[model samples]
Target: MSVMIYPQGRTLSFVYGDERILVCREDRPKVTSRVQIKVYPDGRVVAAAPSDIDDHAVLVAVKKRARWIHQQLRDFRQQYEHLIPRQYISGESHLYLGKQYMLKVIESEDHTPQVKLLRGSLEVSVRQRHSGNVKTLLAEWYKDKARDVFARRLDAMLEHTLWVSERPQFRTRVMQTRWGSCSPKGCLTLNPYLVKASRECIDYVLLHELCHLAEHNHSERFYRLMNQIMPGWQSVKEKLDGMAHRLLLN
Candidate 1:
């Protein structure tokens, strides 16, 4: 178990193996303190408030939900234990464009790593000296690909779905927790792991972030608008959730 105190004065208590987390914050001057619990697919709970909340009260709320948290963690662990092993073997399967691609490792004197799709195969080339660094190298390649693909998808969604006038600046990087995030200023950040998901899953994430430009919260109106734009969004969302757990274990 570990406890962290944020600079913003909120406190967080987390249990790692059990994958449970609890947060407590103080209540505002005129507002009563309350606990807000959100369970993430990765088995984390986030509780938040203003500034003057009671710690014991927060603990009570978390304890009430402890059994549910433990169950989620157990199920997640059982489902993904096999995905935890790191393997860089040839013929290994990877996701791209909503399909699986077999990896074909090639030895080359090229100065930079490169990946090409050749007749149903993904050929990856890296410096021989860096052959043992396959995981990091491939991760970088995925990040680069995610940036390019996400940009195009974002543009398509904005042009077709919402008819937004302004183009938002976008960025991509590796994130441990979130698939993507959008800011009020129109900047969006995407997780590089998205490249490992199917093309439709990637598009789903892209559309999700783009939609934030219109509806910032996950309210009913937001989902209604999302469904209007993407008819099968619910199915895509489920697939993306499963893929996210697999990717995390990997």
Candidate 2:
């Protein structure tokens, strides 16, 4: 079959053997001086090109870096070792605050379904011995903890960010490819699964989004602000990315 030609601003793909490398094309002639390719930790390859460039040229650039892109994808996929689909049964391991805790499920006739961290284990008490109930109970517990943790971290991060005067409205949601995001209106949306990482990592993600309040895009100014706020953010980001699959495991 012939390859399909993607539009200028649409997502494209470079077929590499059995794996298809997704290419996200960004067109910005003034801001983008040249074609620059960046592979995110989530295995997303983005190509920022001048508005004048054609889709074929961008695909060629991605093809040139195909070897490197494959390496990055391999590394990220290796992090998924031992992190399979969760059964939500007893003896399963779960993460809380960068620590692993074995899941302990208990069925009680008179008690309500609840989740608690006790003695290095996540104890889930449910009236029925169903995995769905256990999963729901655990999700609720994580959401509550994430709300409190994200709020506190956001407050602390604001002190260092001199650009943001008033605190932005923030909320939690379950995200597949992002830890956090700042809207054009300055509202921050964080992933509830982020609470599974360490406090330092959490702060890093919050600060990244807060920087968006000052600079919306990943421009040089945005990175400069990120460096000014946290010099070692790149390393922290690497650490978080290294364990993302485990933290996001269901």
Candidate 3:
């Protein structure tokens, strides 16, 4: 039997054993019948059900699965607990091109802020005359570096992709989430934080986007193609996941 949708719906929030959860209802008809819930990496709880299924029903379902949600939250906390808020101050450690470097802040008479990797440190020259958050200054510096380095890497990797028939215009931005994205019009957007990652991880994100030119979704064939072009993509992906919380935490 097909499940008829109600056409109108809303999101209902409620507390379940001290944890806040959101139940989203929508009017999408379906032939399947099942209660679905997802716990995101960031500990957001979202549950969805058929349009005819009211908020109370969704809450009851969630209540029944409280133990499962607890386990998921525990696992996520263990995975991301190492990510600490950044202060963007000197003596703190940062990464560039997959290498760790200490941050060195220098107040200079010049008005323009500049950043450079010198020896084994990230030297940020800030103008004493200007007033702004040090984090913003460091982020802009990372954005500049990401643009220069990502463009070059994209160019080099393009030669290996059969899906890319032409060059894509790439731009860098401070994306709150996501490492990179590719549009059908051949424009690619990259996260500035990617500059702090390793070369292999950078290539993985770039190639993953490039592969979308042929198959826009994560189908089995997409993995096959990714393997054909880059055999060790999985190992590189693992490293990226481990370091993402530190590099991209907002």
Candidate 4:
């Protein structure tokens, strides 16, 4: 697809493969033209504009940064490919609420598949005579657990922040790129694959969306507020950047 440039000087571009990205402007003020690039946790890229900027300037910036963009895309693909081959087998390790647990598959006569969390272990039970795939059963179990955990965290964050607005609705989606997003209407959507990440990373994403409730744009003020609410947010963000590609793959 051709790159689209806004008359206001914002540039939009995309890269397609195991992961697809649509890059555009997050916010553009009427004053100074400065270049700012932000990579969304889900892999989307947003480049800001300066009123004085032009297409040639944007092209130059993209070309100067081409190596970095390609490196990011390559890393994302590698992380995803590495985790896709994972199997839910006995003794395999998995992350749950920021902690690691060993999997223990139990064959039972029960009519439905069930997953349980015990002391440092995850026990998954499936009907002995059923032909259903074990991987599918376990994946469903993970989704359910992710929903429950994320809901509880959301509630705590809302309360702790003393946010007075209407509660934001939440949904889980299977996204190739992006950890979460908050719409203008106060709805927050999270990637279900976040269940594969550390709990801190998940909370980081949740807090990010919650911050959007007060500040829709990622301006200096917005980041200051995030830092006030989450003192270690920068560290958390760094860790999240490292793991984002792996989680997307899962």
Stretches of candidate 2 exceeding 4 Å from the true structure: 1-12, 17-20, 24-83
* Count of backbone collisions within predicted model 4: 3
- Candidate achieving higher lDDT, 2 or 4: 2
Q: What TM-score, to 2 decimals, does candidate 2 have?
A: 0.75
Worst 10 residues of 1 by lDDT: 1-10
36-88 per-residue lDDT for model 2 (tens digits): 77665556576878767889988888898899889987886676453468999
lDDT of 4 by residue, 1-250 (tens): 0001111224466444443444565444434566666554345455666645775676556556656766775676666565545566687777766577887888877546777889999887877623245567667777887799889888877775656366689998776546788888878888777777777777778888888787787666666767777888757766665555545433
Model 3, range 118-214, lDDT digits (tens) per residue?
9999888886623345567777878888989998999999989967889898888766557888777768888878889988888888888888877
Model 3 scores a C-alpha lDDT of 0.72
Best by TM-score: 2
**What's the distance in Å from true for residue 174, model 1?**
1.2
Give lDDT for model 4.
0.66
Superior candidate under TM-score, 3 versus 4: 3
> TM-score per candidate, in order?
0.65, 0.75, 0.67, 0.65
* Model 2 superposed RMSD (Cα): 6.3
Colliding residue pairs in candidate 4: 33-50, 42-177, 42-178
lDDT of 4 at 220: 61
List of clashing residue pairs for candidate 1: 26-51, 26-52, 26-53, 27-52, 27-53, 97-199, 98-198, 98-199
lDDT of 1: 0.65
- Decoy 1 TM-score against native: 0.65
Which regions of candidate 1 deviate over 4 angstroms? 1-84, 109-112, 129-132
